[model samples]
Target: MGLYDFTFYDLIHRNAVCYDGKPAWFEAETGATTDFSAFKTQVDCLAAGLQKAGIRSGDRIGVVGKNSLAFFTLYGAAAALGAIVVAVNWRLSENEVAFNLDDCTPKMVFADNEFGETITSLRDRLPSVDRFINLTDNGPLDAFDDLLDDAPFSGEPVSANDGLVIIHTAAVAGRPRGALLSHANLLCASLHLNHCFNLSPDDVHLNLLPLFHVAGLFMAVCAFHAGALNINMAKFDADKAVDLIAAHKASLLFDFSPILGSILDAGEKNGADISSLRAVMGLDTPETIERYRKTTGGCFYVMYGQTETSCLTTMGRYDDCPGSAGRAIPLGRVELVDDADNPVPPGQAGEITLQGPMVFKGYWNLDKDNDQTFRNGRHHTGDLGRFDEKGFLWYAGRKPEKELIKPGGENVYPAEVEKVILEHPAVSQTVVFGIPDPKWKEAIKAVCVCAPGQSVTAGELIEFVGQRIARYKKPQYVDFVESLPEKDGAIDREAVKQRYGGKQPGNS
Candidate 1:
């Protein structure tokens, strides 16, 4: 099938038949398993219940839940019914959740029972919602399980072009913005991923990432499309992950760099039977990939993509391409374009722009921001990167705040230096800012919040960064703040910048 011509549920149904008796999905905490036949039945029933509730193809349905089997089922059910599913981050404040629910105007909300307080606070605010269903409860308004008790559903399938999901992004840390992704986007992304990774039905996927984020949901979709077993973890615990790998004999785990680092740390301290672990890949810096591969004895892989790109624009094909975010997946047009919107020569740094079936329609309602981001036909990725001679894309840094300058024209990217500085035992959160310096235009300054009960002097931090990164990139000035102001427990860039670039402050 062509990349963009198939509906979202089609992939799951097809894969189910391909590997019917095999385990399709399982919750690590409960040992509950949903094989192909059961999965299909539940999806149909949920779709029927949703349709019975007056939801139609274009209707938006919001789902706010933790990583559970219900999330996967609801997501598919929404697709089957041709409705758009908005995956709201459970980590956000009640006010934020209320704001998003009001803004999105979903037909109904499937909320996690754990967030009942948030729901209680925002119930009045979400007037547009026709119903509030508890994802876990079996009684009352549209309980996830009861709705899915039917053996099968005859509901009509939505087209591939139908809006599939609206995923909210935690904007550099501000009011989150929703990105509208279509069924075509999701289907193409999974298909492209399956082909690129050469996934087989025998593979097993471990899902620890949050389902609210693209990585978490996309991992499930990829595994489903490939007819692979998907093991869903309620949360990321390194020790639990190791145990699950050994017990389930999991083949591949879609993880981030930090998770791998933690697992590697655990592996070094307490041994693990990773014999069944075929691959370990996630979003990480190129340098971290090398270090991780060396430490794990070449057992990990690296993937590179953005949330705007449906999370699978590029990947470093396991074992084939060692360090590069592999060549563009089929049906994607990835370009390294200069500031002038002209394509740059190979190996030259430029903004990465992608045109693909998987690219999101646009940022929800932020037309000005959308125009700024999605210029012409391509989605401008704000990331600075380049394509190498072998067609591998190399990520450099973000276009905005790309460089951290020091007193002597020294330039550093926070992503690169932060990776190294984050290794320090005393640091919990560290942000490097370019403080104004009259002598050199700008000087590198570090604002750090230390780990609980751990302390380090300014001189010690400066030396720590210097030993890891270039000496010039090390902060000339260090400010040990009590705690960084966070919007919702996540780093707030604007707040950080305001804190560093204080009022009435200029060039140093």
Candidate 2:
């Protein structure tokens, strides 16, 4: 049978029947494990619990915490009964968290012990929350274990297009928008990923990305589709990650370059063998990608997608070709279009848009945004990119962010400049943005985090970039910092602007 015939719950159910005695989840730190049959049973109980609590189809339920097998069970359970699970980023500030809680107005929130204080402080603010099911015994709530006592769901909702998860955007431009992904969207994503990553039942997935993000959720779901073992880390511990890789003989790792570097270090330090890993998925500088490839003795797969696309709409192995985000995956059209919604000629940069089954349903409660995103019957990704003559797409930075740094009529993307600055030996991380300039409408400025116990002056790095790209593209001003401010894991440009480019004396 074709995969499109199945829903996410169907995938889980099949895994229980086909791979029943095999391990489905493993927690390295606690040595906790759940086999396929146990996972299916637990999900059934949780779904019935929600149904018993009067959660009807389309009700929004929130789950805020670090990664855990229980929360994943919630994902399946909620989806089974046609309820939507909103995974909240635990790293968000109280105000940020409140913004999401208010936005979704979830009927219930399953949060962990760490988020107890914030929920208590905002208790008066959250009118929609009926109850808080604390993962531990700390909040003004009942225990999560109580849900299993209620009953077990014998049947699931019959719709495949029903919404299942809402993954919020990072709010890089403004307020975060919750991208609603349905069962069809996820299954389509799994179909593309299962083929793109060469996944199989023999493969084991090592997932470290935050579960609140689409990447994390998609990784686990992809494993379930293959009926493979998934070793999901609650949080990345470089040393423990390496040990897990060696112990599980993991085949695939989906993470960023920095985290991959730490794993390589831990493996080297402990003499752990990671030869079992065949592919590592990430995006970074070409040099960084090659370094990771050599370190793990694995192919480095590069892909591009966001919450709006469910997970990844395009992907390719570096070993297949040097660069390029690759052509569109199955059942998708990856393209570059001008502002007029016209397709751009090959090699000309334009906004990247995806038209496919995997595209998300829409943003939750965001009417105007939904219209803007789905205007042309396509997910209009505000990020810019271009297709080569061979049909391989190359990713550019965000359109809004790229629009910020135009100096002297020539566009200079902060990302382009930041990439050069990161190449400097002393620089560890950096942010480049348009700072107001009297001469040029907006001048390019660089804020950098230097390597451990190492320093480089502003002038030296500016000259270094001046040599590589256009002199005008070089950062006119540079500031060295000990650390770059982060929001939702990525560098927060707004926070950096407030801290470094704040109002001067006598200025608004």
Worst 10 residues of 1 by lDDT: 402-411
Model 2 alpha-carbon drift over 4 Å, by segment = 1-5, 137-140, 401-508
**TM-score of every model?**
0.76, 0.79
* Error in Å for residue 188 of model 1: 1.6
**TM-score of candidate 1 versus the correct structure, residues matched by position:** 0.76
Measured by C-alpha RMSD in angstroms, how accurate is candidate 2? 10.7
How many Å off is the CA of 92 in candidate 1? Answer: 1.5
- lDDT for model 1 comes to 0.74
lDDT of 1 by residue, 1-508 (tens): 2354577787667766777777899899899998986788778788888877888877888878889888888888888877888888776556557777777899889877787666766777888888888888643445666555464565565677778888875433234578888888877777776765678888888888888778778878888888888999988898888788778877777765457666666666677765676676665444555655665444565556767899866776556676567778777788989888999999899998888777888878889879878788788877788888988877675676434332332224565556656889999988766665543445677788899999999899888877654466677777788888888878886688787754224432
